[model samples]
Target: MKLHTIVGVALAVLVATAGVAAATPGANAQDSNSDDAAKQGPPSELPDPVPEFVSSIHDAVSDFLDGALDGSLGDAVNDVTGSSQSPPTSADR
Candidate 1:
């Protein structure tokens, strides 16, 4: 009878400890930060990369062609248009 009482008391204590542990909050329990994030709404989506990549490539090619044409034809165009605005050189002085 004494042995049975001791076993019963041990089992009761074990069950109580388990109940307390189950009732306590864990690391991932909801808190203020989660509530704030919920109120802020869904996160913004990232832009598509294909259009951005194509735009960058188009800009690069356009800039390269403009530079090439300007270097090759700019002086000729200026001379023909009589709008050559060259700065004074040592020979001019």
Candidate 2:
């Protein structure tokens, strides 16, 4: 199959390049970089937007469950009972 051929080629390439690698680092320069990085603290960057987006989605779902779906369920119950399909107001709570 095509997948088998692709995997076979990948393995062959890996074997061919197995010995090609960076030389081991010396003692002086490597320690200096690490020491500087430690002094610098965490990297400065824009906040990740993923959490905010996830929070918005969570809020939306909460709103739907707390209000929209609740009202719809009340309407459905009213319909079955041959009552007015109007949504429940706060005073009805």
TM-score leader? 1
User: In candidate 2, where is summed lDDT lowest over 10 consecutive residues?
Assistant: 19-28
Worst 10 residues of 1 by lDDT: 69-78
Candidate 2 TM-score to native: 0.23
Q: In candidate 2, what are the lDDT values of residues 1-93, reduced to their tens digit?
A: 699999999998887666453344545544645767577656678676674445544554566677744445555445445566587689989
lDDT winner among the candidates?
A: 1
Deviating ranges (above 4 Å) for candidate 1: 35-93
Model 2 misplaced regions, further than 4 Å: 1-29, 32-35, 44-54, 58-93
lDDT of 1 by residue, 1-93 (tens): 699999999999999999999999999776766766576656599765674445544554565577744443434444444556764557988
Output the TM-score of candidate 1.
0.33
Task: Show pairs that collide, candidate 2.
Answer: none
